[model samples]
Target: MSKKHLIDRINTQFGENLNAGNTCFSSINKSKQVWWANIHLSKFADEVHLLLAGTGHFLWVTLPKDFVHNLSETFKIREDKNAVDLEISADKDSRYLIDVKSGGTGFDFRKYVREEVGY
Candidate 1:
């Protein structure tokens, strides 16, 4: 599908605020158990680093394999109200951290797949 088509699909499935950002295109692939989201966080935020740092919590819901490889490479788990900080490195070395918050939505892989991929 086209870039605009995919972005529109993602936004409709996820939320209207879902930004495609600088990375105009999204690569969808398949893996064992989940669907991954590989997009630039900046599209949803003004400053990625600042937003992550300010928020004590965020959720990292791993997408399926196809989407996983498309996302930013590295992810860091910031300090949360109930969890400790951690880091997950991707093969491509793209540092993309998703902060966890107490009030934030918990990790839901299936929901993401259903929304983004229309599974």
Candidate 2:
């Protein structure tokens, strides 16, 4: 799926307050276009939701806002872009990453996703 689809998924589950060109999202559906000197709802940065969807792997994570508070100490600033790269590890062999961008911040999300169809 593309970036718009990701944002649409979020909007579909949540509400319209967090939509494109508006609302409290640092960036919805990250793109290489925004990888350099991007802009969005940085003002509402709190509780990061790391959403990944592709291939056979679909993972979503909720990180504490303070997770990226300390740059040099906790996170790594990407020399390649205007963003930071984060590493999220679930186990020794399984690790996820937030590469070149941070997103989906703002709003108290008790639930950011809802299943349209069950397994």
Q: TM-score per candidate, in order? A: 0.25, 0.43
Lowest summed lDDT over 10 consecutive residues: which window, candidate 2? 32-41
TM-score of model 1 (CA atoms): 0.25
Candidate 1's C-alpha runs over 4 A off are 10-15, 22-25, 28-116
List, residue by residue over 1-119, the lDDT tens digit for candidate 1: 54455445555755644343432332322331112333344332331111111122222232333433322233322333222222222212332322222332332222332322421
User: Best lDDT goes to which candidate?
Assistant: 2
Worst 10 residues of 1 by lDDT: 47-56
Candidate 2 per-residue lDDT over residues 30-75, each given as its tens digit: 4332222222224225554444443443344344455454544434
lDDT of 2: 0.38
lDDT of every predicted structure (CA atoms): 0.30, 0.38
